[model samples]
Target: PRSEVGDLIVIFRAGAYGASASPQSFLGHPPPIELTIDGDEIL
Candidate 1:
């Protein structure tokens, strides 16, 4: 599947009340600041 041609929903498993260890996506570092999923960007 192409990364751009689909809807991406990032659900942070971390709690919203308690202090999170990392307020970013656990998938990687420098978490996603902004994301734009466009099929045009897909190769």
Candidate 2:
């Protein structure tokens, strides 16, 4: 699938471990924001 700017993409099975494994902070890139959803409700 293709993602455009401002698109909300969901990745399963990613948590603290995934963050530790990624290089998101490399080159000064900000870390990803985490969101929780429950049955159509965004928490």
List TM-scores for all candidates, in order. Answer: 0.18, 0.49
Stretches of candidate 2 off by over 4 Å are: 18-24
| Top candidate by lDDT | 2
Q: Which tens-of-lDDT digit does each residue in 1-43 have in candidate 1? A: 5566456655544345322444665556655444333555822
lDDT of 2: 0.74
| RMSD to the hidden true structure, all candidates | 9.9, 3.2
Candidate 1 ranges with C-alpha deviation above 4 Å: 1-6, 16-20, 23-28, 34-43
Q: Which residue pairs clash within candidate 2?
A: none
What is residue 21's positional error in candidate 1, in angstroms? 4.0
- Clash count, candidate 2: 0
* Native-to-model Cα distance after best TM-score fit, residue 3 in candidate 2, in Å: 0.8
lDDT of 1: 0.47
lDDT of 2 by residue, 1-43 (tens): 8899999888776666655567777789888777766789997
